[model samples]
Target: MSSYISLIEKGIHVSEKNVCDQDKIWSRYSHDKVDIGEELARVIRTLDKGMPLHAELRALSIGSSDEPQFRILETAFRGGLYLLDINDCALGIVQERIKRQRTDHVTTIKCDFNRIFLDPQKARDFFRDRLGKRWVHLATLHHSLYYCRQCCWLELFKNLYRGFLAPRAAIHAVLMSSKSKDPSTTTWLYNHFAGKFFGAYNDQDLRQLKKDLQRETVFKKAQVLLRTNRVNFYVDDFEKFMAVVWMILLYPQVHRYSLKQREEITQHVYHHFWRKKKPLTQEQDHLVVYKGLGRRGLI
Candidate 1:
């Protein structure tokens, strides 16, 4: 979470509401819907295919509130795990879990990743202080990049490649398409409602990321793997379903839908989805950037 909003830029956001709502959603089902575990596993497996998962290696997962792939990465990297999220509550939950199940392997940091844009040097130093001699061997953004403005995408990756990621490392990011054609998807809902009400179109999807990784001067040397996966979210409870939809739209934070707009959107969902007993589905685009994969420049 970063941008003009000082609260967001400072990572002062809370996640109690989102956590509760997200629980209702994730508690129901996965893989068939919003299960990115398979793709994450593929990232580790691909990196492991060529490089060994050294015990001392490190990983930094941005927006790790869900703490979905923490253990998977713990096993894959066999090393220090840095859990970063803008929401302190999310960090608290993850920290508690880490304390209960693991040793001092996990370090949770609550800060907006957009701080890099505000102060690149300061942000780098902040992470460096925690990491010390460690450099991130595998970094993940998950579905968290939506909090960042599209303009900052390149800067974020550049900083990661140059200052954070170890050589031969990879950064995996998954984002829902901003221009999805499916009415049951988040992208389409945002485009239809937000576009109509807020007059904004989401251009911050993987296509833009692919262009940057493939054409950017620093990223052009890297190997990129692109794919798409479908995640469906459907709950029998109408309130719970709407909550997940709001989370998907990033309501109040990103769009700040008006009460009327929220009602309209809710009604739309009810009429279209709840009545029909269909799930909200999204086609998420996957992007994996492999540093120094082609024997090219590492950064």
Candidate 2:
């Protein structure tokens, strides 16, 4: 298996053991639910003013993980939902949950977003039967766009906007801003080391993405709105935090790192990012909302 796949498997195993405890997991990041809720509410309110109350709206979520976010989107939109994730474990977990909840409107596809955009024709073919003539009205890529390499993000955005979005559709995204508050010493070290293992983006990358979007003809009519919100993390819960971090890092070939180096990295993460005895708070993320009329002849 590829190192990425192996890392994901290990992370899934760790999650099953430690992070799967619903209570513990919820307690650690319950504020995230609140943050997302507020943002979704804003999006809904804005859309409602222009859309009919009973209008059926299709939605898409990239990197939708096994979380309640998809459920919220389905409930609010009352339409078919397309959820994409590269992690099979996450996709299966979410698919099963949706089944149990009787949320038959959701369709989970296990694949990388990059692959989908790499060949737009294939994407259209794969989704055409299921989607028919409908276009997605609401889409989100929350805390997930970073998974794509910085340079490829613009193309991904172009494909998503052109191929999938309906007329006047809104795309909401939350991304870590390099311009945000300075990282903690541990976070700095973690990013430094982690970048060696995976493709990651900094603030400059995000700025470039925005610039590219502005210059793109497809998004010419798009009105981009930006906001920031500080997210709090539980520093007292080291194991839980690491579980989440490992899942994000998902590049588990530790053979590249010497034993001592691994130990040092772990200690740095725990001390700086986890903050040991102190509560950890991340700098506010840049929440960008893109709204515009769809193009004339795309897809």
Clash statistics: count for each candidate: 1, 1
lDDT tens digits by residue: candidate 1, 1-299: 23223322122222225655565565465453225677778777666655654446778888865555676876666578887888877888787887888657777887777875336696578666877857777889887887888887888888888788887789988877778777778789878887898788888878777887788888766887778777777767666666666766667667877666666676677678877999787778888889865643121
Task: Tell me the whole-model lDDT of each prediction, alpha carbons only.
Answer: 0.72, 0.62
- Scored by Cα lDDT, where does model 1 land? 0.72
150-200: candidate 2 lDDT, tens digit per residue: 777777777777888877577777654554334542234335666664434
lDDT of 2 at 236: 46
Worst 10-residue lDDT window for candidate 1 reads 7-16
As a whole number from 0 to 100, the lDDT of residue 166 in candidate 1 is: 81
